[model samples]
Target: MFNISEVDKGDSDLARLVSELDVFLSELYPVESNHCLDLSAVSDEQLRCVIVRDEGNAHAGCGALLFHQNGSAEIKRVYIRPEYRGKKLGEKIVSAIEGIVSEKNSRLLQLETGIHQQPAIALYRKCGYEICDAFPPYTADPLSVFMRKELP
Candidate 1:
C-alpha cells in the first residue's frame, strides 16, 4: 500500500518525479509530439499535484491536476517509478486526483497522454475516461490521445 498526499509543485520529491517523467517522455516521443507542461506552467497556482509514497516515505510516483477558470480540470504529470509499476499505483493516483476534483465540484477531468502509451491509455479507459476531441491549448495532434470523464 502507498500513501497519497497533495503537494506543491516545488516539493522536492514531486519535482524529481516530474523531471523523471519529462525525461521518460523525451525518450519515447519526438519534440513535437511531446506536449508536457513545463515547470513554470506546473508552478501556476491553478495547478495542484499529488505524490504517492511507500510506507518508508520514498517517492513512488506523482500526478497533477490543472484547474481552469471553468468547471474543468486537466490531469497531468502522472508517473510511477519503474519498480513501482504493475502495483496499480497509477490507478490509485488517478483516483486520488479525482477525489480532489470532486471536492472542487469540477464537472469534468481530462488528460492528454501520448499515443504510444498503451498502458496509460488503458488505465484511463478503465477509470471511465473516453477518447474525446482535443480541448483548449491542445490541437489535434496525431501523437496525442485526449480523454475525459464526467464526474458524478
Candidate 2:
C-alpha cells in the first residue's frame, strides 16, 4: 500500500521531489511569469507540506496544505511523478489534505492550477471544487484558475 506521511523540509528525497515539482511547473509556466511556488523560500512550519511515498523508498509526490489560521486554507504544490500519474495518486493526496483542513477547522479549501492542466481541473471538479472568480493576490493573472471546496 502507498503511504502518505508528514515530511519536514530538509529531507533529501523530498527536497529532490520538490525540485522536480518546481521543474514541472516552471517548464509549463515560466519562472519569469511568477506563477510557480518557490519551494526553497519558506521553512517547514510555515508551509506544512506532505509527501506520499511508495513502499517507504522513493518519493512519488509532494503537496502542501497551507493555512492562514482562519477558516480557509490553500492546497498548494500537489504534484505526482510522471510515471506515477493516472494511478489516482492526486486524489489520494487531495483526500489527505482535506483531512488536515478539517482538523484545522477550515471551512474552505482553495487551489490554483493552470488552465492547461485539464486532468487536474477535472480531478478538482470530481472532488466537488467549484470554479470561482479570480480571487485576490491572483486576480490579475489571466493564466490562473481558482477553485474551492466547502468542507462539512
Candidate 3:
C-alpha cells in the first residue's frame, strides 16, 4: 500500500527529496532556466506540500502548491524518486495538489518545466494541463515549457 498526505516542505525527508530534484534539474538546464524554489521559499507557511510514502512508510516522492492572490496557483517541487517512478505516484501527487486547489477555491493551476523534460510535460498533459504562454514572474525562454489547467 502507499499513502499520500499533506506535509510541511521543511520535513527532513521531503527536504532530501527536494535537494535531489534540484540537482536533477541543475544538470539538465542552466541556472536561469531552472525555476525551482529554494528551500526557504518552498518552506513558507502558506505553501502547501504533500509527500508519498510506501507501505513501509518510506518517503517516495513529494510535490507542492504556491497560491497566488489572484485565485490561481503554481505547482512546484513535484519530484518522484528515480527508483519509484513507474508506479503512478506522480499522478497521485498531482491529484492531491488539485484537491487542495479545489478546497482553496482556486480554478487555475499552472507550472513551468524544462523544455527537455518530455516525461514531465507528458504527465502534465495527461493530467489536463495545456501548454500556455509564460505567466507572471516568468518570461518566454527557449528552455522553458509553461502549462496551465482550468478546473471546474
Sort by TM-score, best first. 3, 1, 2
**Global Cα RMSD, each model:** 1.2, 1.9, 1.2
Kindly list the per-residue Cα lDDT of model 1 for residues 68-115, writing each as its tens digit. 877789999999999999999999999999999998889799999998
Lowest summed lDDT over 10 consecutive residues: which window, candidate 3?
A: 37-46
Residue pairs with backbone atoms closer than 3 Å in model 1 (clashes): none
Distance from true location, Cα of 75 in model 1, Å: 0.2
Runs with alpha carbons beyond 4 Å of true place in candidate 2? 32-34, 43-45
Better of 1 and 2 by TM-score: 1
Per-candidate TM-score against the hidden true structure? 0.95, 0.89, 0.96
Q: In model 1, how large is the Cα lDDT of residue 51? A: 96
* CA error at residue 18 for candidate 1, angstroms: 0.6
Over the stretch 66-106, how does candidate 2's per-residue lDDT look in tens digits? 77545578888888999889888898999989998888778
Off by over 4 Å in 3: 42-45
